[model samples]
Target: MLYRLMKYVLLGPLLRLFWPAKVTGLENIPAEGGAILASNHLAVADSFFMPLRVPRRVTFPAKQEYFTEKGVKGTLKKWFFTGVGQFPIDRSGGSAAQAALDTAIRLVREGHLLGIYPEGTRSPDGRLYKGKTGVARIALEARAPVIPVAMVGTDKVNPIGSRMWRPRRLEIHFGKPLDFSRYEGLSGDRFVERSITDEIMYALMELSGQEYVDIYAAKAKELLAAEAAGARPAVPAQTSGARDAARLPESKAG
Candidate 1:
């Protein structure tokens, strides 16, 4: 299969040679059955290194545009992304978002390892952002365990705006699988979902040692941009969680 070929023969070996990733607590990955590998989003390369280090095929939902283009260039892109173990999902909100969530649920139910970024988007700064509850919903709906993963040093290798990857050491720390079995059959409860999401984010914060920010990463990006443009933007309502109180860092050029 293309996945195996790229992982073993084509891309994996080459990446390992250059980036030299070291993994800790890899035994935390289940040998079989469904589970969610929830990680903090730092840089684009988080997607590349995480999957290469894991034994099983890890699938992430990519923007639908990655797979929907036409012509030779589009065809090549579609092939490349598919070979690299990504599938298309509509990220637009409403029904389209629900449909993507449904697809994620179905993947886990079918005994696949679903790689998800609970933060929804990469951190604009290096701080951990508030997680979206989608990961909790998937775990509850599929009745699967959530394994918190922290990818370290990737932001240095592929910084926020860099098109090229630098040779830097990578570390993947896998935390113990979090069981939400007590919340079984409570998938639709928003409060329960938020609680689970917060727990996951706290674990990530501990593992990666990144400062926690209460605002969503996308919103943080908007604020950073607004500040860059010399505009005073309205600060969003902040969450009251313990980690949420961690002050947002001053914006810097990436």
Candidate 2:
């Protein structure tokens, strides 16, 4: 009830006015069945816009931070996320991945649309980075078809550091459903996970036209962090007269 109310009353109108998204190949979505909508994350608004375009109620795992807050603002935030059919997932690895996998399997078993960002996090530079194997693990474990979804121009409206949202044209293109049943018997195998993840990323690359990186999200995070650190300005050397005098005396003694 809350999901429907939020979709139709609050979010729907706001998105229509601000983002004005246009959806294509929505017919590719199964009319009634369990399926995974694997999307590339370009902006935070990707969550709201994708769900709004899909006819069926699609639920994604959102970070728990959105729900943990104090007072009226926290309450509203929690309510909004709940109304949108999102459940919380710890972004941290280890046991949190297991919990997320369990939730996704349950949703698929119940014949609901499970939305996931294969890239794990929003692309920091709008380029489609490599997808995490968790998405493949869920699809194979749940025996659900993976539908590749491409989102364009969302990053332009609300980018990484922007406080305000600009009205822009958003496009959502859903590719054909990809069946991974042939590998169903090989669940929990690392090879199968990597293969399936690669296939999903290939489809997304074709759809979104973003350069594909062949590394996982965790590794990508490390690389990006290292790059950011490397980009920082180097500290200047001290050139005080005392230091110069000491260096000159030490050199003379040597």
Candidate 3:
């Protein structure tokens, strides 16, 4: 199949030759079974390098834009993402968001390795942001363990605005599998989900050595963009009290 061809024959060799990984804790990955690999998104290359180093096939729910763009470049991008076994999901909230979560849960239940960025998107300033609860929801629904993964120095290889990837040494750290079986059957409980998400984010923060920010990555990006446009950035809401968890919507773009 195309996935094997890319991983074994085509793209794998090329990636290993250029951006070799200094991987640790790979043995943490279960030999066979469903699990969620929750990682902090630094660069787009995090998607490429992590899966290349892992032994099992990993599927990620990518933004639908990757598959819907028009023209030849878009065509090739669609082919590459599909060949690597990624599924496209709409990031737009509402029913689309639920559908995305459903797809992820179904995949996990079918015993597939699912890669998810718990922060919902790449960090805007290299700090770990608050995680969306969808990851916890999926893990609880599928009764799967969640592994915290960290990718270091990926931003240098694929800088935010650069199109070309420069060769750089990479480090991948896999933490111990986190089991939430204690909260079984509480997938939709908002407070429970928030607690689970915070635990996962804390694990990632410790593993990645990134400063933890109480705000979401998407909101950080919005503020950064506003500042760049010479406009007043919207004030970030307080996240200290219990009201913070209660106010967060169930889903976000991940």
Candidate 4:
């Protein structure tokens, strides 16, 4: 297919010539099987560079907005992602999240290599953030192994505002797979899911060597943007009497 041709025949050689990289831990990857490649997302190029390093094809969930943009650029992006076997799904709605998870589970069952960024979004400051539980959910639900990967120096290759990738010294490190087989049938337990997700994040932190921040990347970006805009931080609602020491008096019945 065109995807294989692009990955192995066409683009593969071109990348070797222009974007040569040192990839380690290939032995950690199964020659053939369903597994999750969970990694710290540094830049947009992580999507392409990660898959390009592995001999096996990787499929990742993409934002629907990427495929729905309103211009020739959007069309090209849609075509590229589609041709590379990436599919877009809604990420905001609860039902849509479940739908995307189901799609991932199906891919795992089909023995496809699934690449996931537990951080859910690119790190705004290149620091590793707490991972979302979706990775754990997918791994547990599909009974697949999760491999922690680290992409080094990719942000420099394709940093924010960069339209195209510039040649850089990129490295791909694949760590040992984290097995969650003991948590079988516990996917419905949120605490279990969190524990699994946290374990995966720990592995990523060790592999990536990036400073760890106990917050989601997207939320951290929001806070940074809010601070930049000089917006007042919202106050939490008072839920207890002690928290309502300055509460207004209630009106008596007239």
Candidate 5:
């Protein structure tokens, strides 16, 4: 309906005309079934170019702000995102991560191609940053395969602060599907989740050829913002009653 109409009639031609993708290993995409497409986010257009080029309709969670504006323009923005199969979600608050995980698991279980930026946000400087464990949690909970996808040169079309998209060539590459069934039923194990996330990230790095940064993108952004403000980044508060898997020994991961 709306998805097909946009792709076949409206945005498909425009996207291809402006920033056509030279994709490789698209056969890696499963013909039919639930799977997580875990990609490295480098540009705002990664959302656009991705769904446009893929044969199947892909849905990703977008920021709630995109749907909350109070005007005709805001209405249109909401329409466009909804038309293209995207839904809005709040990206803040303490429960946000759990909410997102729940949404992703639901989507995958319902047999939709869920596109997730494992980095959680766009790369601040084109370097592939550490993936959060939420992706692994979703994959394990949904019992779905996670496919590592890489979109290259998208930053040039839609850089961090650029208002207008500049036409540029882009490349999309899909790596082999990563199965985490060996660690099935262990979604609650943060160490195991970290292992799964790291494995997917390793494949993404190889496909995108971006420098790898082992820290989360959000943390990196916080550090950069703090530095610009002439303030040292605030250290994270320790959990009162939760075990920090980061401090756990590797041998105990099993």
Candidate 6:
């Protein structure tokens, strides 16, 4: 009850006022039943903004730290996330990933909308990276349509290192649902996982128009952090001459 009230009456209105979002292709989202909204992660605010645009309550997996903190802040964080329908997922590898996948599958099976970012972390350079195969696995297991959502200009609103949000023009484009019914039972095969993941990433690439890097999100984050900290020497201009020479096309939506 609180979640619905807050979403419609308070949080949603305030977010729209500040961010001034323009949403497109909202009809692509299923009005009823279960589905997966696979989006490109560009900033921390992506989670909040995406949910506010969607009419139904979309539940996303949040890092366990949000729920494990201590004292007054911890309690507030727990309540806030819970009220917003986000559940904690242990991000550590091995059993944790499996557990998170299980939780997501259970939610979808129960007719809930599951929001997942295939990159698994916020993109540092605002470029879309390769999607992790977990999303493909879940979609296949749950037999849910995966809606590709692209968020533009969110990084400008709340870029990394900024303490507060800056009013910016945010736009969310929802691409037509990508159906993977043909790969229904092949979720266990590694090759199938990779193929499905690649397909999803390709659809996102068309929607987001960001340079696609075939690397995981964690590695990119580490490299960016190290570069920012000056621990690693900066790449000389000469070394990047080849990449610099190439003319990259700007995103039409951005």
The local distance difference test score of each candidate is: 0.86, 0.81, 0.87, 0.82, 0.83, 0.82
Q: Candidate 2 residues 67-96, lDDT tens each?
A: 887799999999989999899888688888
Off by over 4 Å in 1: 233-254
Candidate 3 on 11-42: residue-level lDDT in tens? 99999999988999999999999999999999
Residues 1-254 of candidate 5 have per-residue lDDT tens digits of 98898988999888998787899877888898899999999998898888787789899999999999989999999999998889888878869857877998999999999999989898887878878888889999999998889999999889999999999999999889988887778989877888777778877877887877777889988887887798976333322211233233334545
What are the clashing pairs of model 2? none
TM-score of each: 0.92, 0.86, 0.89, 0.86, 0.88, 0.88
- Candidate 4 segments whose C-alpha is farther than 4 A from its true place: 69-75, 230-254
Model 2 TM-score, all chains together = 0.86
Model 3 residue 109 lDDT?
Answer: 96
What is residue 248's positional error in candidate 4, in angstroms? Answer: 44
Output candidate 2 Cα RMSD: 14.4
What is the lDDT, from 0 to 100, of the residue 69 in candidate 4?
A: 95
- Of candidates 6 and 4, the better by TM-score: 6
Ranking the candidates on lDDT from highest down gives 3, 1, 5, 6, 4, 2
Listed per candidate, the RMSD to the true structure in angstroms reads 6.3, 14.4, 5.0, 10.4, 5.2, 6.2
What is the lDDT, from 0 to 100, of the residue 99 in candidate 3? Answer: 95
Which regions in candidate 2 have their CA more than 4 angstroms from the true location?
221-225, 228-254
Query: Which model scores highest in TM-score?
Result: 1
